[model samples]
Target: MTTAAMPATPADPGAAEAADVTGRLDALDDMLRLGGGRLDPRLLDEAGALLDRAGERLRLSGEHTVVTLAGGTGSGKSTLFNAICGLELSPTGLRRPMTSKAHACVWGLDGAGPLLDWLDVDKRHRYARASALDTARSDTSLQGLVLLDLPDHDSIRAEHRAEADRFVTIADLLVWVVDPQKYADAALHRDYIVPFARYAGVTLIVLNQVDRLQPEEVDDCVADLRRLLQAEGLADPRIVTASAASPDGVLGFREVLVDTVAARRARAQRITTDLDRLAERFAGQSGADEPPAGVPAPARAALVEELTDAAGAPAVAEAMESAYELRAADFVGWPVASLADRLRSDPLRRMRLGELREELRNAFTGPVGAQQGDVDNALAAVAETVTGTLPPPWARAVRAAARRHAGELPEDLGEALKDALPTFNQVPRWWWLIKTWQYFLVLATALCVLWIGLLVAYGVFGAGGDGANGLIGDAGLIPYVAVLAVCTLGMGYLTNLACRNMVALQSANHGERMERHMLDSIERVAEAKVLKPIADELAVYAQFRKDAAALRG
Candidate 1:
């Protein structure tokens, strides 16, 4: 005999939906972690909790769509739950709040046990149309549904209320069973209905125990409930009236469930609702939904200027000017002035030039001081400029990022300045040529003095004895010596004047070169310490905004 294998159970309809939600949540977690302190801590915490719960729910049952029956005390939620399941699955006596711990009724037991376990529902019953005593098959449209009978939302015990809230958060669908008398309860409308308006797609409102009301009164009650739902932001909500005590009262409620199950879209719809809620939470905080414009040009220029001052650019440039002038004097000054220049302290050394040069050659290792204050002020200004158009939360995040970037400013600025020192340390070739001319002028002056002295000595010796008649008297050499001495002195004075002008011109050129180097160094520091951090934050914000938009979609 050939035995036909029973048809394999169909794959869980929600598997693809669950996977998509899981991937989105993982991406969100990564984005939040990268954002770190730059995002609102409270929002981050809320998002993390939601992600964890979603993961747990998805893992437990991608085949079953968990629907919760929630209502206030005396709302007959338990009776309605039993009527819908066609069994005595929930206690419905005079216990004030009939249900305490949640009771679940699984339409098909296969692959649904783990979902019940995750939901913490210890009381569970399995039902299937195929196992019914009647030979004729009943409708099996609700095959993968898990219906929950939850404790009253307004129970006297806080734990009962808390339990109701917990299930409500994770359930794929919610059926609010309100009695006619309590249909317009302020607590129900304000606390549950309005807050869950974003979840309208997965919600159903049933007016249970409507058999207690007159036929004429039922219309008025449902109309009143509809108005309240609309006021709470659920425009044109799905609302029905049923009397679970009556045999046929639950048929209407059952038909809605059958339709819901037939579609097999509750799981995907529920996840989509959750994403919508999250996107709403981040609505205002994400700003204009476009990439942020970076810091303004004026603000950037101002920041550079402030940083330059803080890094001692002005002091370094002035030192360069003085040092150049002094150095030039040493190389090209008159012999007498050269000696004085050597005796004086070196200008660059007196200004701590060696330390500054070393700081630039190495990385950021400069001493921190008053200059840091300027850097701080400039950073604050830039932060304000860059984040000015952002929402308050994002602006605060950007500001915090700016502060963090500025922490390394002082050292970085110092290093930049030091790196620029080599540009100003160069010597001009004209200095050496001027020095050679000055040396010749010195030699001529010395020779003239020697010549005059020897002539005077010969005249004195000749006057005492007859051996030598004075050369000065023989060839009018005394006048010639006098004229030569005067010409040598004049030459020395003129040479000294020319050397002074040359040194001054060289000093001016070196000063201009030093200024350019100093400005360039400051610009580098500004880029590292200010502009780069703002750009990084903008990039992060852009990614976050994109993720938010995807979630919304």
Candidate 2:
């Protein structure tokens, strides 16, 4: 059958009562799902979370409602769900599924629990508490009113089962529908009713569509049904007659529901009585003295930090900052035997330079950050932190310089991280190291080029051997690199130089940005993002504890 909402009324007090009762049912359902009675702190924390979100809403809006209907399919539950709410319905649509899917949630008004989110839903309808019965418009019901509707309880989907099971468990006032045909369905009694018998007092069992029998013999069938419930160990279960299609037995059934003489005695209390019980339950949960059933503050805080850090967002964001300073430097060539090797170490020089800039920024920011200045030094320090010790900076510097000069960032990256991770304790190291290394290398190479020119002017320029000395001094290109792809390599080297100078300045300004990002993420993880839910839970527990204490007093 297609679902349609209740028609608006002049002053619908019926729905106001609905909100209060439905909200309480929602609260109980939330508690059950969150494992409120268990030691699993995560579930309890979630429970505490639920309490905080709905507290104000509970207090202000739906505090005067009664019975809430929920059950499974083939249980004749939809016919029963509608009978309880007393909402009229049309025949099923042409292509309705044998098992309904969309939940037909009928509350006297807006419900109490975070039912929407748990449903993974975003409801666009507006539902608010009507201040008075006369003011109650469409769905809003008054105290002692009942809400009815079908749930897609028997759907193949797990989500549907969860939704139905959850709603059934939480309702302060609930009805379980069973037909004569499938009255003994194990899923109904075992999956829903039996385990929740602790809540049987608020329950109603309806033998719906009983009008199919001889009208005069309805009483005998209802009697046999009551005996079955008694066999099920339900206390004085209230059995009602309902027919969605016929509409004859429903009015009588509705009166019994609102009058509250069902299976349990609690339903008899007016909607206000139920609301008071709820306020009592939640108020206790909210108090400072309440048991710490919700999330521990520290754990929640930590989780938030972890999530933020996962993005590496802080460092990326902070690098947009700037700082600058200048200093003089010198370069010199080594022995001819080592000449090729030394020139090849051009990348090492850039690495060292980048390391320097990063350290400077760290110094500027404060304690605990990425330090720039000599990759040898910082790498050693970080390595020590990661592995407890590493080679000294000077030795590392020498080794770096000793590496094949042909090394380029993209080529060496894989190996560098391999070394950095296990030995140096670097996680996510390659990109940063490669970037820093490139910037530092180009700057050093440029400076080295300038040094060769100075040396030439002093002695090597005018005194040439077979034009080789003059060639080396004048062009200032490494002899071998110049021989093959010199122009391409030269352009790379020159562009690298320009880019390095700019990056060097940029790094100087923003070197600690990464470290800052990591630190701030940790702090927020400890504080706001993580702590918010936990603190909220603690607050609920406190309020609950206080209320419990007051009740005890």
Candidate 3:
């Protein structure tokens, strides 16, 4: 609602206006409840703003009394059009009109393109000396007023017929120009006046070429035209017997233009009415009052859900599980030697412990695990390659969610990966071969360790109780051999532990660092890459809507 200095008194006009504005504002609320796609949602909002502008323009049009000089060929309409422009602006409508004489003259402010366009006029009149007119005459009341010199309304050409239709859309005043002979012609009443019967109050009829009509015939022709106009629904349409060749009704038409339609109050009312129409269109799209700060609640949920589904959560979880298992084996595989070392040493292993879980998840799966710390971390490096890649709104929400839930990585690391996303679990073709080789290495290492152990045991126990033909070659030397063997086996075991544990720890540490970097990368993208730009664009749209509305008002 608007508040002005004039107020307090209930009957004050200013207060009434404020109340009216409040009413329209309240009406806007009802429109936004209906929502759907961007076509219905975003598109509608913009269309509404445009409509508001169109309506405001319409009001500006209303203040000008349009007195079109219309007639058949050689009816002196062009001459009359010139006379009208003698006090108006250039006469553009007659530039190439079929009449071979002058027709309509339009008068208004400089920004008359929209109005002329609405009238389907490719050319229109503008004041060449308007600046001088302002200095020469102090009156500024004619700013929105327009006068037209039209082509023959009865022209055989379809193009001429089209011009008439165009004028009616934008004209607030219509002054029909006819000669004495055709003033009461059936073609005029049936073709033109009858169609605009509903707008009779703004219609005026002019009979040109009255100089040729005898005094009695003039009254008769005027009376016949009046009766015809009445039957066509212009019950009280003004009939002014005019002569462009002489000087009869021209001054009266000019007087009406300056006095009634061009009056300030009339101009303002027209503008206000046009604004009402534009507001109505806008309100229907955006919320009638104020649009919600963002997408509507229902729309927001739908969009987020749609985005999450597209992110492929299941895939990320699978990838994480594989990563965790491989990493864990390396951390604890010292007894089996390579088992622990290989798993722990893999670059993919260390990321989950730090921030690499989400990144790994995302790389192995898809955006589904972007919210997961491991996946987020894993994607950091990948994000750099696609600098401007923007995530859907839902993806941002999911990433934020993953950050909040990142603590779970350490506790439920395996399960988290399994449930995180399905896409991540699908290993590449090369990884399949690698996994097969991992199993083969584990089996081969086990077999070699067992064979070596058996050979040493047989050597120690080979000196049988009989001490003859012994498998290891001597019972008396058994104790000495056993002692030597114990030392060698102990040394081998220690070497194995040190080799696996030390190497595994170094690899895991490096992996963790990489994972942390990956997470940083993904986080930066969720913000700088996607969220910021979308927010900025949406804000611009909102502001545009507001500015358009204010201008219309």
Specify the highest-lDDT model's number: 1
Each prediction's whole-model lDDT (CA):
0.74, 0.44, 0.48
What is the overall TM-score of model 2 with all chains considered together?
A: 0.36
The total of clashing pairs for model 2 equals 51
lDDT tens digits by residue: candidate 3, 1-553: 1366327524422334344443443333223322213224554575455345434444334324444555565566666666645553333344445442223344555555555555444453433223233333334333445566666766777777667655644455666778866666677778777866655655667777687978998888888888878877877878776665555456655555555443433323333444455555454333223322333345333433322322433343344444554544433333344546556786644555445546664453322233454434533322222222222332333234324434433233333333433343443353344435444544555554554454455544543334434434433544554555455445445654554465456545544544444343333434443334434434433554564465345
Residues 1-553 of candidate 1: C-alpha lDDT, one tens digit per residue: 1134224433455557666776677766765775577667787788788777777776665667788999999898888888877778789888787788888887767888777778877744433332242123245356777888899999999999999999888888899989988888888888899889878889999999989989999999999889889988996799988998788898888878867775566877787678678778877767774655567789888888878777777776666666666666667667755556548866765355455444433433445422667878878888987776777777877787677757677777776766666543566787778778777767776776765565566664454345555653233466677787677657756777887787677667766776678678778767766677777788778777777766666
Error of 2 at 371 (Å): 42
TM-score of each: 0.84, 0.36, 0.40
lDDT of 2 by residue, 1-553 (tens): 1134324322433355445455554554544443343224553555454454444324433333334455545555555554443443312332332333323332334443444333322243213323353242222223334343434466666766665665553444676767766666777777666655445556778777676778776787888777766777677887777776665667656666445422223422233343344444444233232234333445344433333343333443343222121211111111221345557777765665567546433432322222123222322332222111211321232233222121221122222212221111222333355445544555555555555554465335445544444435554444433343334335445544554565565555453554454445444433432234334434443443443333222
Q: What's model 1's lDDT at 126? A: 37
**Model 3 Cα shift for residue 424 (angstroms):** 17
- Counting clashing residue pairs in each candidate, in order, gives 2, 51, 51
Ordering by TM-score: 1, 3, 2
After TM-score superposition, the amount by which residue 171's alpha carbon in candidate 2 deviates from its true location, in angstroms, is 3.2
lDDT of 2: 0.44
